[model samples]
Target: MPNWLLPEFIADVLPSEARKMEDLRRKILDEFRSYGYELVIPPMLEYLESLLTGVGQDTEIYTFKLIDQLSGRTMGIRADMTTQVARIDAHLLNRNTVTRLCYAGSILHTRPSGLQATREPLQIGAEIFGYPGIEADAEIQSLALASLKAAGISGVCLDLSHVGVLKALIASDPLAQIFEAQLFDLLETKDMPGLIELTKGFHEDTRTALLALPSMYGDVEILKEAKKILPDTEGIAKALAELEYLAGQAECDRVTIDLADMHGYHYHSGVMFAAYVPGLPNAIARGGRYDHVAEAFGRSRPATGFSMDLRELARVLPAAEKRHVILAPWSDDEKLCRKIGELRQSGEIVVYELPNSRSEHDEFVCDRFLVQEADNGDWILKTAGNE
Candidate 1:
């Protein structure tokens, strides 16, 4: 293989896509900042235990582990930033009042999440800690929607779920609790045959409810049907009510319910959601209430957040227009140099034309030129190719 060949599912972002991704990153971060989410930057990697503290098997499978030379402890390249931000909130910031934090960075996964997915994803997200109400969940969901809107993605559908619904059912019966992991896997895949075989020996009501969960996905009306069929446990009731409220509060084109959605099931403690756009079958972004992560760090704060791969998002967006630039001749003249500096400071892209070379930039088009007036010798701007 050629030395320049990248690994499978990994590729370099060229100038055009990189520009779009950077622009989206800035706009989304600004949207996050506008909501008072203080930006935080965590390390690219951390101790294995710290990275895996409150995440599930999915994240564990994604993380890339390494032996740290300094401490001889296992370190993991972060596949997700949620827990790291939670650690900062629980241990570092140590704020007693409500705290809002946001982060943007690249994360490495051992394998691609989908056939078209990249192993290295640019992740950006925001979290709120110390607030345990459904209102926090609502805010996070709204922020996720707004972030997509900032990126110019439209026709979004918010898919909502709650881990508590399944948690309640499992906790209500010792038999179900014993097979919790199995049930979780089956439900995530919606493997009816497997769920049937696994739940055959359970209580009648437990088996019935477990079977109904997979089919309980649709519009918000599914919540009403869930209320009628599912066990009326306190946990299930609270989870359903929260979903209904968020569905009502969601400011998007559509809202959906998926009672059996087990994404981040082990990681999220309450309502979870994924955003879907028009073209992609997979979710564009995912988030939910994860109040358990801080507990792993010994602070026990309620946290909710969402993250998306900017590269994946950029792939769907239309290509950005080539930036317009003013071609300036490289010169030692003080006035010419000063004029170039002024244009740069004023947010114009001024490219210097080196001697014996033509201007070349893949991401920019030289539509204007800086020239000295023939009569006055004063530097001025003129349209390129006019002369």
Candidate 2:
């Protein structure tokens, strides 16, 4: 066999892990359904152009592309489900009104340089299109919180920031263009000292506000503190007000406002947020308002959405013992086979095996075992541990 069996970042989801992931996926989908967000099973592969329409070129580099022989056009595997749903909403659904769509699928991407982010990630999320307001942001955040609760995650911190606020702060000074890149880098790394050093050239007030940005995290109180420090730019004020309003509306107990949290995705316009749980260094789920993504696709609709990485959630979930029942027939009885088939059809995990050697009927390597009687009678069921 050739040495190269699989690529570096991608790997198989074996039966055990796959089963657990499917269970988590179903639970999340059920939660989304409860919220009236209709499920959408988008195609695994799409046209390269359609997929690359809204999301920037940096994200596009991660996609795996190929030429379609039948259509003689470039096709690419979906690297993100958000853009795919946007295309569906704009072109397929074609409604100017509000729509809630949810999806669960695998998104393929190349491994980032010096990072171990999985190449194939299982994403489950919802998109809200055509809603325009901070109210929409609050609703999405609420839904995301509820979804996490439903998945049995507790003590979640909702890290909220406004993309517009950050952009406005950068736009205020003539030197903004020169310092924008470094400022973004500082925010990404949560480096307060580096930010303080970099902003030394700015006025004292602006410099102090910029320095304090990284630590402006906590409840609604932090929002007030941010307002006091940040220059009274109209955009920044609006963004702060929106965050405060969102905090009031959100019912979650653990909310943190990180004014400096800036993730560089072009689609995120208004507010961006991520859900963090214990044991996971990065966010288990993230989403924000991207009103312009639909417009980039030529439909010009406002949209906001978030996705939970199933793999990350699985890592944090407590190990659940699998329940199994085994079926063993001493004789090749047709009726026994029929019964086993019925149980299997009813969603029971049954394993049919040859008759056991022990006198005990359930002496088998499973949670439970079944045996057929020589006489025409009901089958005997026994717990494996008891036997």
Candidate 3:
């Protein structure tokens, strides 16, 4: 490894990209605030046990851990912020009523999540706590769609799933955790052949429904197909109804269901969804309902939210907007300084030239400058190109 080389999957964000990311962050946060979601900033790291709450085995693998010298306990750098926010809701605030929270921060993953993913991602998200109704799921999904729109993102396709379908089946025929883990891995990969081989001993009805899941994906009609082929149980019926309602309320251009899309198997208890925009190989945003997450923090609260990488969103968005700049000389003239201050206060970027240094900045468009029409006279603004 060379001294100047960065670790694989980690890269620096230059000024232009950072500016765009910040701009979008502010816009999305403002949108969340409008919907009554107050912002909360969680620390980058926490005790290993607390951080692992409400997360799956994969999240633990993705996390980077260290020994805490202060407390002699293991600490883990956050790979995701949702569980931390849940801690705040359950242990700290302990609010019984409905509470909405939002956060923006950098999460460090042990490895890149996808082929084109980053190990360090700036995650921006919002969560609704203390709400368990299907409406809460709908609200979060709608909020995610709105955030993308606020970021100038279009052509978004939202893939929806309700783990309740599978959970219902598992409840009827409980299996050992080890066997369930194998089932989860197979479903995660959508490996139908492997799934068929593994579930060969299951009852005919259960096997048929499990097999039907992989292909029960597409538009809203998939939900209809699911109800027909899957076991006629209360959990399945309820999940199908909830997905149908959420799909209608999503307000997105396209919505579909993936029955076997149980990405958050251990972490999420209800609906799971991923949002994709055109040209992005992986989902730009993902979220779902994790009703049991709060229990890890000592109180079980119904929660739902979504998170997206600001850096990834910035990369796909249009170029950052260029700002007009007024470049002026470094001087002690009180009036000239006052005028520059006024321009800056009025939201214009004014760059002051340093004494005995380079006078030109290629980065900014210096179309205007401060000048004095005559010596000992009032300062005036003039076109730099003309003067």
Clashing residue pairs in candidate 3 (N, C-alpha, C atoms within 3 angstroms): none
Give candidate 3's error at residue 28 in angstroms.
Answer: 0.3
Lowest-scoring 10 consecutive residues by lDDT in candidate 2? 356-365
Instruction: Kindly list the per-residue Cα lDDT of model 1 for residues 109-157, writing each as its tens digit.
Output: 9998975888999999999999999889889999999999999999999
Local error of candidate 2 at residue 130 (angstroms): 0.7
The candidate scoring highest on TM-score is 1
Compared to the true structure, candidate 1 yields what TM-score?
0.98
Residues 140-232 of candidate 2 have per-residue lDDT tens digits of: 888899888887888788788888877887777666558887888888798877876788777666666677777787777988788778888
CA error at residue 106 for candidate 2, angstroms: 0.5
Runs of candidate 3 exceeding 4 Å displacement: 174-178, 359-363
Question: What TM-score fits each model?
Answer: 0.98, 0.87, 0.96
In terms of TM-score, how similar is model 2 to the real structure?
0.87
**Top model by lDDT, which number?**
1
Q: Is candidate 2 or candidate 3 better by TM-score?
A: 3
